[model samples]
Target: MLVQGETTFEDCLVSLNVLCDVLLTVAKLMYPLPEFVLIHKDESVLKDIESLENFRLNVYKVTLSQDCELYDVELHTEPNYPTLGKKFGVKSIAEKIRQMTDTDIEKLLSKGESESPLIIIDDVPIESEGVHFFFRVVKQTQFEAIAKQGCVVLLDYTADAALKDEGRIQEITSRIQKLRKEAFFYVNY
Candidate 1:
């Protein structure tokens, strides 16, 4: 999780090396010879990967586009309207997601790479219809869906206030572990 520093890029690279060593040690203990380790590093951490571990680690750098925005069309849906207006069309949401995903696909394609399982992590609030609509669109696009992958995971830090009930953390952790076994990875931020 090291990022660009206030001074220079070299400092950031040094920080990333330190972080990667720590992460590699932890990963080795967690999984039995993990074939592919996807490190969500930005441009700053790219050069530092080689210096971190002796063994090869399959790294995927995440680059978020500045132009795209998550538009909540539900806000525009007027009250007393039967169902909703065409302005909140599922097709629009699907198109936006397609464009966003296409950017990443194009980058991979340029490097002569093929498609892999994708896991998206977001921290936004989830509403009922919104969740259903999103999953529907994702399925139509042929992307496998998971809750925390498609939405957000309630973190341990919010355990006391947000999820105060006893055994809540344990419950969430179990579910996350189940998902890890089935899906690409857990998006526990």
Candidate 2:
């Protein structure tokens, strides 16, 4: 099959920003909660509140559904706007991506890299040359579920040392849970 229009390194960055925002939003839901803003009522009028607005996250995936022939492939990034807007006092994923220089993207996309944020273009597996361009979601990004009007969590094993060995952690947790069950402590998943 013939491939058309080059997929630049910058395109990868845009995609990553979208993905990271989704992941972080999931993190907020499952693990740590976002800061609770206690709106003061004495001066003017306000109530204590955390964000109650619904957030939308859209991920564009490469597909071969319509046509067989290769066509002009442009990176479409309109969906990531809202997530970028909810910045945590730090640069939003989108803005951080915007701030990156071309050289920075080049380096980030280069081969022989020992780092997090593994970049994969299309559904292809890791190659020796590293982050080359193609288009499609990787296996890792495959969505098993989408929670509407509710919270969801995505676990990150690498973030903590204890979490690195997930099987061991799960086993230990299971054992503790069994002991709890024997002790009349019943918690549900």
Candidate 3:
């Protein structure tokens, strides 16, 4: 029998085996992995998706060429929580942060000494004067253009690209796996 809070040697082995299986499945795809993948979902959409207590979405980036198809999937639990500077339409907070004096920075770090928007840095609480403007998360509607870039694949949640592609890739992966299992020409060799 297994205890509620305790883990046994066999339990650890099972966890490791599952991890290995996932890795092996990824390797079987045989595609050149990209350096990174980017996800661009609106804040409202993200919130709605998270409303389901146990539902976690799997977003995948698929690249296809004449002879190769690659699927890259990442599971992200943390939502994007930018500083209040973004929410307030402050063009560049980096410059303001850099210009702050050591004392001002210290105020943000002091326990309960500073208010929000000033003390929050990237969703983390800091100890600041005038820094309460930094704690709030940026609303996507107010600052979407700033996040766009060139050459990178952005899975935009507002459009069909992200949704359409994810379904297609899953279908392809399933078909490939089915074919591999059914192929029997090499059974004698």
Model 2: per-residue Cα lDDT at residue 158: 26
Q: Which model, 1 or 2, shows the larger lDDT? A: 2
Q: Which stretches of candidate 2 lie over 4 Å from their true place?
A: 1-93, 111-114, 117-189
**lDDT, candidate 2, at 157:** 21
Q: Candidate 3: how large is its RMSD?
A: 17.8
Best by lDDT: 3
Per-candidate TM vs. native?
0.19, 0.16, 0.21
Locate the minimum summed-lDDT window of 10 residues in model 3. 67-76
Better of 1 and 3 by TM-score: 3
Per model, state how many residue pairs clash.
Answer: 0, 1, 15
Q: Model 2, 58-99: lDDT tens per residue?
A: 111211122111222111121134432342222334444444
After TM-score superposition, the amount by which residue 165's alpha carbon in candidate 1 deviates from its true location, in angstroms, is: 40
Ranking by TM-score: 3, 1, 2
Q: Which candidate do you rate higher for TM-score, 1 or 2?
A: 1
Model 2 quality (TM-score):
0.16
lDDT of 1 at 96: 38
Where model 3 places Cα greater than 4 Å from the true spot, the runs are 1-136, 142-156, 161-166, 182-189
> How much is the lDDT of residue 17 in candidate 3?
97
Per-residue lDDT for 1-189 in model 1, tens only?
656545577877998999997775434332112122222224444345435555543222222211212211111111212222332444444443344444443343243313231222142221222321221222232122222212311111222332333334545566568879798775768
On residues 55-143, what C-alpha lDDT tens digit does candidate 3 reach at each position?
43343333211110122221111112264344544434444554555456445445454355444444544333334322211233311
